[model samples]
Target: MKNYKISAIATTKIPPERIFAVLDDFGSWPTWMPSFERVKVDLPTNPVPHLNYQFRLRGSVVYADMQVIEYTALSRATSFRINVPPLTGVNRCSIRPLSQGRYRIDRIDTIDLPKVVVGVLDATQRARFSRLAQEFLTALLRTAEMRG
Candidate 1:
């Protein structure tokens, strides 16, 4: 198996608190995120906090089920893979307070896949992942800015 780690950072003109608020609310993802077509937990009301959910990719229709492993208010959030064959990865989002009403948003994704498929997948999937990550962060930043 081969490990793939993708890390990205973005500077936003929004406060850390606002950014963290948006990041913590997983239910609101589909509202602002263009890449996620649907997001639903197992419950209707108040759902089971920290539960897992299956997400459908907007274009590719790829589905990935992820479980909420760690969620710290206004600081850090982490999730673990629960689906997607032969791939187990942890997704983490963090926010740091920066100078002058600015904040640093960081996403760290660690994926483990088979070595044989790496070359084939890398050429096609890497760009898609990168673009998705960038778009997700950018959307979050835009939402936070609008809320301010």
Candidate 2:
């Protein structure tokens, strides 16, 4: 098996709770998250460890499953195990206060790809994951800032 690790970081003036609020709302993901034609969650909101959600890829029949494996409300941190067929991902998003009215948001993803298919496409997928992580952070910040 081959592993690909990626981290996306950015600074924002929004509060941690505000940013986290957007994450808690799965229904709103389609507005910001790319490739998510539809999302389904067993719980209403406020994700905690063990909570699960699923999303259908846009223009595709594939359905991805994501399960929350860690969550810290006070720290505004959450981790998930994402399974989308041949590849499995462990993704974490966290927010830390940087200064007064400033904070940093990070999205770290580690994808375990099969060794057999870990050739040229591996690089492409890594790049894709990095883009998605960065995009997720940017969208989350935008959504949170717009809400308040």
Candidate 3:
């Protein structure tokens, strides 16, 4: 497996709680997330470790199963495991409080792609996922701003 990380950050003049509120609502992600097509939730609305959910991302019709392997509220961070083949790793989201009532939203993806597929789509996937990350951040920022 080839491991790689891509990150994106967006700063906003809103409280971290406001942003976290939006981020915590996993069921509502497809509505605002850039590449999310839909989510099939089998657990409660509130998130917890080990909870499973399936989501379909735009540009791909397959809905991958995912699990919340870590949810640390005190630090405002959560890590998800992609429980599917061909691709695996963690997608971590976090909120950082800043001065002046501003907050920084971060989405960091640690993707482990299969070696055979890595070299074939390495450059293309990196660029595509990077763009998607930025777009996701922009959408999250806008959604939080409007809510705040």
Instruction: Give the top-scoring candidate (TM-score).
Output: 2
lDDT tens per residue, model 1, 76-131: 54544544453677787777778887777888788887788777776567878887
lDDT of 3 by residue, 23-71 (tens): 7666677788875655554444544333343333322343445556555
lDDT, candidate 3, at 41: 44
Q: Which portions of model 1 miss their true places by more than 4 Å?
A: 43-65
What's model 2's lDDT at 108?
Answer: 79
Prediction RMSDs, each to the true structure = 3.7, 3.7, 3.7
**Deviation (Å) of 42 in candidate 1:** 3.4
Stretches > 4 Å off in candidate 2: 38-60, 74-84, 122-125
User: Order of all candidates by lDDT, from best down to worst?
Assistant: 1, 2, 3
TM-score of 3: 0.74
- For model 3, the stretches where C-alpha displacement exceeds 4 angstroms are 44-61, 74-85
- The sequence of per-residue lDDT tens digits that candidate 2 reaches over residues 1-148 is 8886889999998877787778767556777776554654444354433344433223244445555555575233333444445567677787777877788788877778677666757677778878988887888888898998
Q: TM-score for all predictions?
A: 0.74, 0.75, 0.74
